[model samples]
Target: MTTPAPLRFRRNDWLELGLAALAEQGPAGLTIEALCRRAGKTKGSFYAHFPAIEAYLSALAGHWRETFTLRLMQEADRGEAPRDRLLALDRMALALDGRIEQGMRRLAQLDAGVAATCAAVDRERIAYLEKLHGESRCFAPAEARALARIEYAAFIGFQQLDLGLSPQELHDCYGTFMRLVYPPSFRSGPRV
Candidate 1:
């Protein structure tokens, strides 16, 4: 048999591989050699995409923000009603890989750049949630802000707990949370 051709990786490829590595092995898995080995690529391929490990880490943060937060928000915005938007957002958010989120949180504890990125993403999520809750007319502005934080806390906490929950289990757990916190009038939807 002929020898296999060399692997060629693009920037996004490297970022995706790095994210997977982070999820699988935590921050320790992010070393240049580890990433290269996981991707079956060479140092040259990685260096061509990123000048250094710091740059790679920074890009990985950006990738996470784009893929997990901003994009989900955009998709959720498609729903006309605020309640529908909130449900859509919840569905997508719950379906995300919690391991990656836990990995990102761990990385944030180690890297200031990643910490700042995580902070920004948290703010963005809370702000969107606050807006949705307020617009749903289910709560007053002050209540909406407080509820948003509570909901966000639940999301982060679930990731940390790692209860071996499937997406459906996680969704059901959030539904239970919503049923407990939201008024009965707002609990008629399939989400609850």
Candidate 2:
């Protein structure tokens, strides 16, 4: 039989490979050489998708923001109620690759574009959380805002902690926080 054609990676394929590299090897792993090796492709393949390293990095950040933050928010919004939305968001967030988020945070320190992307993601996430909390009617506008910040802070902190904490443990901790901080009516709703 004739040999099959060589695999060609598309733009999104390169982006996805970059995310896996980040999760496995951190920011340093994002080098063109590293990524090409991981994909078993050449520099030409990468250049076809990205003009330069800076552009590739920006694209990678955008990819991360789209996949991790925006997509999750959209999916969570599909829930029928605010509490259901919150729980769905929590489950989705917890299921994400924390290592990739940690790598993005690490990259943010060195890249202004990445930093801005991270900041935007943080703002978007908090705003979504605030909206969900307000819709739940468990807290006033200000309280919802504050609670959203607190919740987002916990998520960021938990991702960066890298203390071998499993997602289930994080989810349980979040459930506990919800029980303790949420109103009695909500306390019952957020139970794990």
Candidate 3:
């Protein structure tokens, strides 16, 4: 099979290559040699930026956190209303790169550093959801927190577990989930 075409790699280029490698083959596939081949570079180039594989992995996790989690959270917070915000979150969830998500999650299982970072990401997302549910629904804090946990769990399960869903189907499922979790007042009609 034809490999990725030849390309020049710069400082951030390694991070891009790491992400693509993580997406395609999980963390196990991210190596200096593999990335060098994929980017048509050399060990000299890789070492120029990363002193060792651990450093590269650290950078990879940081890149994913900045690009994916933080960006998605910003996108989801753009709306004024709770429904709008939650839908924005659903849209972001639906748009996540499952391959990268799965790869990172698997890495978390085997690597302590990755696991801590992944846990932090999860905690941030769950906290955001919890606050949204608590504020919008005015549920008891415990109930709202539970709802948030459920929502995030479902998102992780759907994406990482290889649930067979066409894009449209997953979209519908997420929409349905959001609707189900909406506050009763919000669901009936206009916000009360």
Candidate 4:
């Protein structure tokens, strides 16, 4: 008989799977059996990875935060201009809207642990943005702080709108908002 290919999996496999499911279906759909089935792993594997369902969900939130930070920083690194850099950060937030709307935010609403993890992620993003703003000669320290808060809030509001715009459209809308909020020096080039 032909031997089956060896199954290779890591301890965190289910946690990753759980996050994806949560992103797709929300916390209500993240039952243990659902995750195992979605992951193509056994219940034993889930048990081996997490002591309980709550433990797995907590791990999933941490995973989401790490992933969000990495993506934002990567985008921020790509722009040569500070204004462009901030716009890039806004793009990252737009990219996250679908995942956030699908389930993660709702999950946080019901679970304090999940909410704290999500808040931690938001705090980290804001702190990073604040540092970027402070470093830019384009704006005074107070202005930078205020701009960061405005940009952050605007991005969140756009995401909540579920307007279903393409990424380019989202960026353009944000760019327009930035122009109205910041001095001319801080306006990025046309956001096409």
Candidate 5:
């Protein structure tokens, strides 16, 4: 029998290490040399996986989108009430503390390619939210879309606030915002 090829580090392994580096030290600090050091690999390995730095960065964007989108969708599918699903998503996003999202957003501001990737991710996320809203029948389509926008904005805004607020305070604030933004049709009725 022919001998099998020895195990080799995959491109995803390098990309994951690069993403970790980006999270720790923003996009500006991300360099191939640093990434290679972190991954304990050589420049040749990086080159073998990606054509160039830009290609690596693009791959990073795709990785982030896939990771974030999957988490959100998984939470959304957890059989909770519609409103609860949205709140769970808000909590999950907050839990991330916006590190990866902030890194991607900053990169987008500086690079057109990154910007396009970020936009595509946003569009995909919004479409997913729209579908959830429709299936839940929690609110009219327009209202659901509007609430989705509000939730997204609030989550991002709180990240930018960087006020070091306690988690309880953040949850309370989110609850209040949800009450205001969600239509009555979407809310649970008063407890008896």
Candidate 6:
């Protein structure tokens, strides 16, 4: 039988593959050969999109930056009430790709470019979180700022923790963590 036409992998196709590789194998392991193998394509296809590995990595980080930060900001902007926004933020935070986040943090530790990108993303997340904290109506400005820092750290730490939980179980865990960190006034909602 005649061979089928080669699959057409576009720029986004490469970026998505690269993002997966970033999560699974860190930046140092993001070789063009590995990407090509994972994508089931030849080097030609990869070169068609990115001139080099650095460009591909940059595009992958940019894609994550755009989507990840936007999800937080968009979620934080929802729900007029501070508690509602907090809930939205919590849900978004829990739903994030933990593997990619961990991989990014690991890469950020060694690479200045990745470090800067991670810093910017952290700032964005903290800024949105601070706004929600300000509206929380329980803490003064300095207290809110301090609480937000701790809250964001807890968010990151929880993601790294291997609870081996199913979705509902993790949701329960989030609820428990929220109660520990937030005052009773802000702890309205399911106790589970």
Give the best candidate by TM-score. 2
Off by over 4 Å in 2: 1-6, 189-192
- Across 1-192, the per-residue lDDT of candidate 1 in tens digits comes to 111324667899889887888878899989999888877778998999899999999999999999999999999999988878988998899878888999999999999999999999999999999999998798899999999999999899988995888888888888888778778887776652
Report lDDT per candidate: 0.88, 0.88, 0.79, 0.72, 0.72, 0.76
Question: In candidate 1, how many Å is residue 125 off?
Answer: 0.6
lDDT of 2 at 82: 86
Error of 4 at 161 (Å): 2.3
Q: What residue pairs are clashing in model 6?
A: none
Q: List the residue pairs that clash in candidate 1.
A: none
Q: In candidate 3, what are the lDDT values of residues 51-70, reduced to their tens digit?
A: 99888888888888877788
lDDT of 4 at 129: 77
Any residue pairs clashing in model 5, and if so which? none
lDDT by residue for model 5 over 56-162, one digit each (tens)? 88888888877777767787679567666766776676566467788888888877888998898877777767766766776788977876666666766776677
RMSD vs true structure, all candidates: 3.1, 3.5, 2.9, 4.3, 6.0, 3.8
Worst 10 residues of 3 by lDDT: 1-10
Off by over 4 Å in 4: 1-6, 78-81, 188-192
- Indicate the residue-level lDDT of 112 in model 4: 91
- The lDDT of model 5 is 0.72
lDDT of candidate model 4 versus the reference: 0.72
Runs in model 6 lying further than 4 Å from the true structure:
1-6, 163-170, 181-183, 189-192
Regarding lDDT, does 4 or 6 come out ahead?
6
Which ranges in model 5 have alpha carbons more than 4 Å from their true place?
A: 1-8, 183-192
The sequence of per-residue lDDT tens digits that candidate 4 reaches over residues 36-139 is 66767678877887899889779888877776676678768788876677767776766764664447778989889989987887777777777788877767
